[model samples]
Target: MLKVVVTGPLAVGKTTFVSTVSEIKSRHTEERMTQAGALVDQLDGYRADGEAAKTHTTVGTDFGRLTLDERMVLYLFGSPGQQRFRVLWDDLVRGALGVLVLVDTSRLEAAFEVMDMVEAADVPYAVGVNRFPTSPVHSLGSVRAALDLSPGTPLISVDARDRDECLDALIAMTRHVLAPLESV
Candidate 1:
């Protein structure tokens, strides 16, 4: 079995990505937003569910599983987006084979922290640009440059809500994770 992390900034669709790709039902530790959190969270560029504002947030990690073959299975962990929840990252990345960093075009820089966490975890990672309906067009080269990504790092566009796109992203990440093993 392989363990992978699906992580990104708030409302970037980590939950939707896991839900779309997992063969089995996903477990979520979500809670309704309360007035107490008003000062704790930011509401910038929030466009989930087409609601004027997002209400629910993941308090803990979201878990799901996907079967690649009879002998292969992928365990997916989706992370909470807020910086306050960063303490959970180290634990969540344990035994993870790789990380799939989802980037929101509108908020590309928001993914920096997630990428840093992946590096800290000492795992291979690929960046997937999660497309939103309102997202403006950005060239891949610009994205690569903006993120200061090495030329070899995999960067692909994906729709977190689309199964095929998620599958493609997963495939890319798997390849990246295994490349070192294959070369050795």
Candidate 2:
């Protein structure tokens, strides 16, 4: 089994992305933690609307499975974004091939902590910019510069609700992870 971890800041659509591409119904262990309680987790500009009703902040992790081909099965694990849950990252990332770090253009700074953590872990990762209704459209180059990503890093736009787009992102990560093995 190939493990793929989807990590990002709070409310950046990590769960939604996994749910979109997962073949089996994804299991999300999510509970709403009060915004007032966690000063580090900000809910600014988060609208409480129709979709908001179903929104869940991942308490631990979201689990999902996808069969990419006859020979490979991907196990998707989504990490909780709150600072307090940072401890769970090591456990989630162990033995994982790569990570897909979701980002919201409007809240780019929110993604910094998670991105830094992934880099520190020495895990190869690609950035998936989740397109939200209110998210501003920006060039990938600009977003990469803002994120200070290296030229080799892959960055792509995706709709969290679209299954094909989510699958494409996962495939990109797979290719990134496999390139070195193929060269060897």
lDDT of 1 at 130: 88
TM-score of each: 0.94, 0.93
Best by lDDT: 1
Among all candidates shown, the one with the greatest TM-score: 1
Q: Model 2 off-target regions past 4 Å?
A: 35-38, 48-55
Model 2 Cα lDDT, one tens digit per residue, 23-88: 899999988666564576677757422245334488899999998689988899999878889989
Q: Candidate 1, after superposition: displacement of residue 119 in Å? A: 1.5
lDDT of each: 0.88, 0.87
User: Candidate 1: misplaced stretches above 4 Å?
Assistant: 49-52
Over 19-50, each residue of candidate 1 has an lDDT whose tens digit, in order, gives 99989999999899888987877767577745
Candidate 1: deviation at residue 163, Å?
A: 0.3
